[model samples]
Target: MLDLRSFLEVCKKEGELLELRDVDWDVELGTLTELLAEKGGPALLFDKFKDYPEGFRVATDMYTTVKRFALAIDMPPDTNGLEIIKKWRAVDFEPVKPVEVATGPVMENVDEGEDVNLLKFPVPRFHERDGGRYMGTGVAIIIRDPDEGWVNVGVQRVMLHDERTLGLYISPGKHNAIIREKYWSKGESCPVVMDFGPTPLLFLSAASHVAWGISEMEWAGYLAKEPLEVIAGKVTGLPVPANSEIAIEGEYLPPDVESRKEGPLGEWTGYYGGGERSEPVVHVKAVYHRDNPILAGTPPIKPPNYAFAVQVRTTPLLWNELEKAGIRGIRGVWEHGAGGGRMLTIISLKQEYGGHAMRAALTAAGSHAAGYMSKLVIVVDEDIDPTNTNEVLWAVVSRANFEDSVSIIKGCWGTRLDPALPPEKREKGDLTHSVMIINACRPFYWKDRFPPVNRASEELRKKVIEKWVNEIPLLRG
Candidate 1:
């Protein structure tokens, strides 16, 4: 079984963490995170919150760096994307059946009915323009299938509407949304438990988009190289981590399905869409927490944050999975910085023929999240590094012939998050939209000889850095 205590200890040792005492969620936590992310910083923990009872607390900025992500998965501190990909590819996950205990820290403090106050905790006002305090950015909401006895753990952002109410955004097609629909179909309420504080491996497992019929908690156990000790939920009849700091047990009923305005908050796309939309409202039935409970914080915003680290970890793994499916000569693959891991993917490949790159691009693009709005897939030559915008643009500028390189396919698929598509198309039916796969590689058949370039050896580059380190003012002490 996974021990969250041990995992957090490892994070501290790996130089990926920070602990702050007596912090507030409204302005202090958000301000600290913004400042820390700018400096390539560590995770922050709020030991004491402003309005919350003395036992209430919070932590934020987890997985802010690649080094931190490596540490989270028990990899070496210096591990890069390639190394992470190699390790993940070699590993196959086995399901872990949870061990139950009589009771644990989560039950230390319980608040029910009118006494249950969400505002008592450090639910942060993340963006300046956010309408309400968010308590679920880093939390995992647990639900069980009525027929299968299978448990689903997913990372869904929840907005704190009041002391006993929550605004949950479970878009259609998500596992939780599907489960909720099942309950609604039967004219019954869906039971759910939301875990606020969790171990890094468990958090990652919950965040991952795994295959159907797979239990996320079991996947987490495999990732941790151990079985996750999960206990049955008191309210939801679901399995939950024994060491979870806070567990808010609740239900979603058709009667409680009130339409409230959500969002206009900064999305990962770095764009702000206007107004509130109708979504399911959650009514809290019970609240559980450990002694001196610690709250977890995550800013659901644009790049250069914890979200960026998750995308960075995902890119190489996704590339590895695609290659394993038989596509070859994949020189480089990049999930574009602005897209936030959805809209665009850039690939560099060795083309066998005219449409070789296009074929590979199509396969890779559809590898995951294919039905999203306007999936832009661009393919370049081996000389280009897709991660580097400058290098990618250079290939497009020097080699890409607009007439030969560009191709567009209309009426593909789209998602609810895509602002360009109509709201109705996002929620129902296939999101038919135009898609493009641009071949930016040089036309090899026409060129007589390849261009030569001067490059430095790894050893020589290291030596040069060492030699000039003292002479370089930035490098000098």
Candidate 2:
């Protein structure tokens, strides 16, 4: 609850911290993380890398599991994905505003100008085909809107360009990109502070879409139920988390003067869609860190687990938007967990009128909070569990008239990282794409003629589980 360091301490106490000593940094450090993550391993804290000193360490898999993710937001360890987001949506965030601090752990050691060397930290080559060791994953890039004066924080993939420079991949619609353009339009270099490994919640809140103009720090305060501690950055003048593990303050040089080649790192979509390209460069002006800093490495490794916590935000966000839109009979909403909580979403509703299911589907697909990049949006009756793919699919195949139910709206907001996108269109910055909205709910005209579910009821299932408790191990949960 205090900082990333405090969260790691809690993880250590709960036996969620996996300490690995004296590992190789080149590819070995990241390889181990990927292998352990695939096996559903614990949070990794690597100390004494082959080329780095004992104090310079790296950590991975911070939110790889539900237990770890719940800890990130101070929730119960066993809280599932849907529950986590729902609880977050229920919090009363009444502008807890950031409290300024004199000094903290992140500023313990400071380097300015040519003295700043990013290579001091243990940057890892996360995958076998990676272009180089990256310093951007699991990091929060802090920038304030030049006009609005409100801050924007985004967790973007950063490439370590050199000893004094770094490159970042800011998606087209992200606030950071918009804010940077505002600075660039004035023909001035945009100052930024790269906040690294302060807190997992800090990263989560920063990366989320809280409403426009509201700072992510305010949202973090909402999650912590207390004002977040921030300090004036030494160079950038932006607010940096008081207890962050590392801070890299720099100016985003105009692309005309300098640019850095970035990419090929696997993104949260579990694929490398964009590949390599030239991106804006952040010339390092100052560096700050705690003594023997732990660089948090949250690179998107293989499929599935990396995006669980990332996707949780979307579930509640979409649900709340629907309620705000005055759409009634909304029973539940779920982002298919295995889809990394991004592409596939399902909405369950009690059909109150004709076209209700299609209406819900269209609303979800067009949502700004959670609709972007959604590949398939399925709407089902309240009887179906949106979180359960098997139930949703059964409803789809059984209830839907294939030709009438499927609706594809072309040029809808999409992501550049979508692997299915054509290379030429991606290069041209055409992020919009078609989304398939499927209404799997039973036809309103059928009324009482609709076929009843053949499966046993939940009461009967619970009764069976209670009666056969001794014989069925899987039913214990």
TM-score of 2: 0.94
Task: Assess each prediction's global lDDT (C-alpha) against the native.
Answer: 0.71, 0.83
Q: Which candidate is the best by TM-score?
A: 2
The segments of candidate 2 whose C-alpha lies over 4 angstroms from its true place after superposition are 456-477
Per-residue lDDT tens digits for candidate 2, residues 1-477, read 468878888899999999989888788888888888888889999898777778888889888888998988888787787678777674455666888999888889999997989998888888877888889788998899988889888888889888998997887777888889988888899999898776777788877767678787888887888877888987888888888899888999878878878888877788887688788899999988999898888888655766677577778778877877767888888888666776788999999899887877888887856776888999999988887879999999999998988888898877777889987888788878888988899988785699888889999999999999889888898
- Model 1 misplaced stretches (Cα beyond 4 Å): 1-11, 113-115, 147-149, 254-256, 369-374, 419-434, 444-477
- Candidate 2's displacement at residue 291, Å, is 0.9
Worst 10 residues of 2 by lDDT: 87-96
Task: Report the number of the highest-lDDT candidate.
Answer: 2
Query: Which ten contiguous residues of candidate 1 have the minimum total lDDT?
Result: 365-374
| Per-residue accuracy of model 1 over 238-268 as CA lDDT, tens digit each | 7757788887888876644564666645555
Q: Backbone clashes in each candidate structure, one number apiece?
A: 8, 0
